[model samples]
Target: MEKKKVLLLGGAGFIGLNITKFLSENRDYTITVADNFSRGKKDEYLIKLLENPAISMIEGDFTVPATYDQLEKDYDYVYMLASVVGVNNTLEIPHEIIRINTALIYNTLEWLKASFVKKVLFTSTSECYAGTIDAFGYKVPTPETIPLTIEDIGHPRFTYAVTKMLGESGFLNYSRKCGFECTIVRYHNVFGPRMGFKHVIPHLAQRFLANETPFLVYGHDQTRSFCYITDAVEGTVLAMENERSNGEIFHIGTMDEITIEELIREAGNFFGYKGEYENAPTYPGSVARRCPDITKAKNMLQFEPKINWKDGLKLTLGWYKAFFESGKESFEKAFEKPKANV
Candidate 1:
């Protein structure tokens, strides 16, 4: 039998690279990783994976329609994981977030109109429903059915979610009309190594490594359910391959919710830091509590998250610790800071 042909639109990023790694390891798919390297180039782990010869790389600015032309017209599976993410960017450059993300979504949908992709997976985020939970007091461990709302539509932070909302509607409707299978997985707080320094875990690792005397735990009481990247990647692959997932939205995350204090204290323990803690204000527009109800994913796709938060957090802390000590600027920060700079 011929090898399965796969396309990953943003495969060089954190979750994308993990998905690519998992797919290439256990299957015989000829995978194409198309990334702008907006975050940065492939890391050592992803580079090592490329040596397997089943994977190939394509670099381009995917926000443009011409970028889609470089991709193969026919793919057995297409994972549309491209987007401008992170709260920093949303807060710093909401306009660019709107421009870039919207362009990427629209360009891809228009391209898919003529492409011969059999099935596609659109990666979404829990940010889509953050306002719903915060403003409406929606139940915790929110399910996929929660209505995505933004408290302030004009606010910069909500711009990211707005574009994601557009992508979700665009991909699902496009698939329905264009005759391609589609599935959506709204990720909760997925964290792991190579996730970049802008995220909470990496920042915490940095502070701990620096031995800050009075650790400032931002949003100390805010709660989230963190999912390990490996488990998230597995669930994503399952959603793409499972026949029952087409036209369905699943929450791919662990249901174990914990507070910021618990997370920080645990990381503090990992770094052997004995320090006082103080609660501090966090990013504006951030939700107070968030988690995913993954029962749909569990029952429909047998998606089970295996790594505990502390266990996964330790692994992530280790990677970020080494990276910071390397005296190297991360790819995302390097590219970001220069853009006036998000």
Candidate 2:
């Protein structure tokens, strides 16, 4: 009767923190959270989690190979969640995204080559198949089998997906050659509190809180299936722990697809804003429609999302509202709307 040891690289971020919280509450494991705090801040949420004696924190730039030295050579489970995320970061620093994300994947793979980690999970995104949908009209509720493509390799936005594609291939192949169990979970639109202000929900919350007279809905018709944080955490853990999931890729999201208009209007209702709504252009290279077919996860791992979109939406909006009402500033730069393309 021994406790399992868990290592969470970049575990201070939104989904990573949620995964840590879930494991700490429900599993009998000693968890180590390693992060550099570049994007994921040591905010109140993370600080509170560290109070649990079972959890420990390591702060270092994981993009550096030397930082991996600080981690133990043996781990019962390793969640490789480190990477540069968010469309804003992709747009602002595409080159840095390529550099840091590639380095993280390479360094971790090399480290695993010599380490004694039993199992590993790499978190990816739906953005990997966005090009297939946009360029070739791939089916909606896309599954893990779709070919990964980039419409414009030169576009800054697609840089994020390119690195994710690398991580997926790198982890799966590395696990086969290096003799470690590996699983991948491509997250759809997972959203919740502490998700940062750069995402759509938080941006909407901020706009409504400001009482904009006419709220603009960027890509009003574009569709996405949003998964709640807890649901995502459950699917991720299931993928990692389930014996059937090794070397398998699962789509960890709900099938509840809705339009951008629905999201914006619902967010407006939460803020009690009676404002005119206008449709506007979205970010460059933004996908027109994206959702994940989670049947593989459901059938193989019995993964199911519990929180519906509206309920999840309300919970997220409420958190953002409280955060703004407290007059607390965003640790990262608040997202600004770009001028609509003519």
Candidate 3:
């Protein structure tokens, strides 16, 4: 039997690299990770993983349509994880997000038309329906079928969501018309080791290590369900392999909804800091509460998230702690104040 050929479009990213590691380690998947390494150079984590003979890397700005020509025509599975994400990016460079993400989606779809890929899984986000839940009082544990809404279409923060909605519609419609299978997975707050510095978990870890007194907990009352990266990767692979999932959308997240206050103080506990915490305002256009109802995934993929938020938080906190202590500051440095003009 021939080994499966897999292409991870942004494979060098946090989640993408984890998926590559999982597949290359335990399975016979010859993997190719094409990423521009915008976050930074290939870290030791990715460098060690790519040491496997079955894995390879390609560096290019995939937003450029010409980049797709560098890829091979035949792949059993293609994981579309490439996107300009991060609240900071959306606020600072909303137009760029629109330009790059839309281009990536268009180019990938065009490439697929001329390629021989059997299946493509376009990764999505929970942000797409945040407005539906927060503004309209949709059920707490949101399902994939809930109508996706944008509270403030003019807000910069929503540019990411807008592009994601486009990808969902574009990929499914393309698969239908172009003769290929497509699956969509809207990730809740997926986090783990090496998830980059811009996310809340790592930022908290950095602050705790810095021993900031009166630590401010932004949006202390807001809630989110965070899925560990490993669990997320497993759910993604299952979505692709399970033939029953064709042309279907799955919410790939855990049911553990936690608050910003709890997550912050918990990190403080992990770092052995008994510092005081103060409530602070979260970013604009942020949803008040968000969690995914993954019933479809449970029923169809038998996907169960094993790592709880607390345990996952501990692991992530430790990694970030070690990372900051090692004098590596690029990730946190990237989380700068959003400027009025890009």
Candidate 4:
């Protein structure tokens, strides 16, 4: 049997990397991981994956049109996971976020118009509908049918969400006209090992390691549903492979909602921190609560998340602990203080 040709744009990142591994291990596909190594470096995990004859890597700044020339015209599957994410980047360099994310989405859409790709899965985030929850008080355990709203267009933090909204619209509309299948998956609080330091989990790991006394629980009341990486990858694959998913959007996350205080205390417990805890102001424009309704994904794709938040948290905290204890520094800028949880 011939293997399917699979292309993962920005496949070296946290979720993308795991998706690649999952496919390589379970499915018969010749995988090509295209990335610029901006955030997803040539890490040991990525390097090890590349050692597999079934997997290959392509390095390029995909924002440029010429980079698309490096790819084959025909592929059985294309996972468009490329984007500029993180609340830190949005707050610090909103313009760059717009530039890079817009360019990547637009270029990919144009390329897909002419390519012979069978199906494409565009990864999105729960941040896209955060404004709906904040402004309109949309129901918690939000469903994919909820309207996507931006509270403040001028706010720097919404820049990431804005670009994602563009990708969602662009891919869905383009697939209708361009003759390729497309599905969108909006991830909610997906966390696990190798998810980078800019997120909440890794930051908590770092602060606990520093032995900060009187630990501040930012957004102690804000609630979120954390989905483990493995479960997220499974949901994504099901979305792409399931025929009924075409032209449909799925919320790929868990429904287990917990408070920020609970999350922070869990991390504290993991590190054996016997110290005082205080409530502190979280980053600006952060959501008060977020949890995705996965009924659509469950019904259409039979998606089921097996890892509970507590177990997933332990796995993530353990990875960060080992990484930090090894005296290794992050290749990207260290997020010293807590920013808007992304």
For TM-score, the strongest prediction is: 4
Candidate 2 lDDT over 238-331, as tens digits, reads 9999999999999999999888889888888888888699888776677888888999999999998999999999999999889999999998
Best by lDDT: 4
Tell me which residue pairs clash in candidate 4.
none
Q: lDDT value for candidate 3?
A: 0.87
- C-alpha-based local distance difference test score of model 1: 0.86
Q: Comparing candidate 2 with candidate 3, which one achieves the higher TM-score?
A: 2
The parts of candidate 3 lying over 4 Å away from their true place are 335-342
Worst 10 residues of 1 by lDDT: 333-342
Residue 39, model 2: lDDT of 81
Write the residue-wise lDDT of candidate 3 on 1-342 in tens digits.
Answer: 898899999898888998998898778889999999876358888899878989999899988888888899999999998999888888779999999999999999999988889999999999899889878999989998899999888989889999999999999999998878999999999999988877788778767777778887778888888898899999999999999999999999999888878887788888898867888777666788888999999999999999999999999998887877888756445444321110
Pairs of residues clashing in candidate 2: none
TM-scores for candidates 1 onward, in order: 0.95, 0.97, 0.96, 0.98
CA lDDT of each prediction against the hidden true structure: 0.86, 0.90, 0.87, 0.93
Query: Per-residue alpha-carbon lDDT of model 4 for 200-246, expressed as tens digits?
Result: 89999989999988998888988999999999999999999999999
Candidate 3 has its poorest 10 consecutive residues by lDDT at 333-342
Candidate 4 Cα outliers beyond 4 Å, as residue runs:
none
Q: Kindly list the per-residue Cα lDDT of model 1 for residues 1-342, writing each as its tens digit.
A: 988899999899888898888998789899999999888476787788789889999999988888787888889999999898888888879999999999989998888899888999999989899899888999988888889898888888889899999989999999999979999999998899888767778777767777777887777888888999999999999999999999999999999999888998999999998879888776556788888999999999999899999899889899888888999777665222111011
